[model samples]
Target: MSRSQRPIVAFLYDFDKTLCTTDMEDYAFIPSLGMTPAEFWPEANGFGRENRMDGILAYMYTMIRESEKRGLPFTRADLVEKGREIVLFPGVQDWFGRINAFGETQGVQVEHYVISSGLREIIEGSAISGAFKEIYASEFYYDAAGRPVWPKLTVNFTAKTQFVYRINKGVLDVSNDRDLNASMPDDSKRVPFTNMIYIGDGLSDVPCMKMMRAYGGQAIAVYQESNRSGVEDLLAKGRVDFIFPADYSEGTELDRTAKNILRRMAISDALAEENQEQLRAIGRDELPNQARLF
Candidate 1:
């Protein structure tokens, strides 16, 4: 089938902890400032609490303040360079190609997206950055000299859902709020919620995970040993449909489950297409018999 004729399945991901082993900053940014993860996070979080600032903004500010104090490079280029230090989880480097090939065999178009609270610049510089159609994340507004001046975008847990809608409507432009907020029929959407799969980590992912459950989409939480209990709590609370180890290797549980979801969504798309065709053939506005749809 042609690209437009094929059903589209979107795989949405959280960058930190989900794909990478830990927070992206922990890999290189924090250490470059002569601070450990232990020292930085508490300070950042504490700054937010004390100033009633948004946590993401607080961290961005802290990164700026600390780096400047240490006479370190705090330019956008500097941040992107830090991305090179990020260590991905098992098989993540090959996961996209494998999943995309499987989607082709099933006659569906697969797309990847990063909906993250991490720095967009950092994610853009990662090894697998090219795999995604779009990376929606917190970002810094840089000056003419390439120094970060202010927060251009800040994606907290709740803000992540906006990217989901953007993907659904094929409105990838971040500046186009008019089209994003405008009414459009569900049938006219580029990708339905049923064709989306969201992969995230723990509590910070709850809003997006719950959105998946409430809609027809699927929400999966991947955990490391350190965060297993947290993800388990999410599962128990019915916020996530599945919890797996953060392994994306071929034949791994995450890989198999992702392929299965793709297959199921593809079948559902085919059935929906057939139903529409039948309705058109019968000159009916809707199906004559609701039971005719399986």
Candidate 2:
């Protein structure tokens, strides 16, 4: 098949732990509160437990509340600026382009997406943000003065599943488009489940990993070398299609797995198309009535 005729592979990644070493907020925001991650996280969790607030919302609220107490600006720009300092795992900067180019060689289109609970503004400001086709993540609301006032969207584990549907339907807006989300036929969706590849880490990604795998998509559970036990557990539980080191460096396990998956997906797509064409040819030659349907 020609390059233009190749199928598109959707590479969906969970950002916090899968792509980066730590949560974006903990990198700068939590420390800026003059508290350790241990100290700040427990307070956030306490608020969630007491008020029944969503954990993500509680964290965002804590960020704003603490910033005010410290006389620091809680502006969206401030958060984004802090995001710029958040470091990525090895080879992340070149991973996207490398994978995209590799996909071309395999006769596939590679599109990257971020399905994360991290701050959208922060991710947008990160060095590797431009590689993604869409960023489905938490975001904050701003006041008239452009200062962040409250959490606008608090993406959680289950909420992450909605992004898979959004990617399928090509819907970017989180609001005001109910029918497309509710009524689109599965075949009419832009990216089929079989062409999706999800990369994630830890329990926070269980919902997404399970959903993608259940729907014929592939899910990879990634972990640091020290977390081999956790990676093994995910594989044993059959929560992912594969497991590998979090490293994205070229020639690493992750890089090899990803390239192989893309190649296989392309082959599968080509075989399906070939089978369809054969069926059409058979219909044209032997069944006049069925030929019309083709």
Q: Best candidate per TM-score, number?
A: 1
TM-score, every prediction:
0.96, 0.91
Count of backbone collisions in candidate 1:
0
Spell out the clash pairs found in candidate 1: none
Among the numbered candidates, top lDDT falls to: 1
Question: Cα RMSD for candidate 1?
Answer: 2.1
lDDT of prediction 2: 0.83
Task: Mark the 10 consecutive residues where model 1 has the least summed lDDT.
Answer: 285-294
Candidate 2 clashes: the total is 0
Question: For model 1, what is the error of residue 111's alpha carbon versus the real structure, in angstroms, after optimal superposition?
Answer: 0.4
Model 2 lDDT per residue over 56-171, tens place: 89888888787788888678887788888888999899999999999989878899999998899999889998999889899998998889876788889898998888887777
User: Global lDDT of each model?
Assistant: 0.90, 0.83
- TM for candidate 1 is 0.96
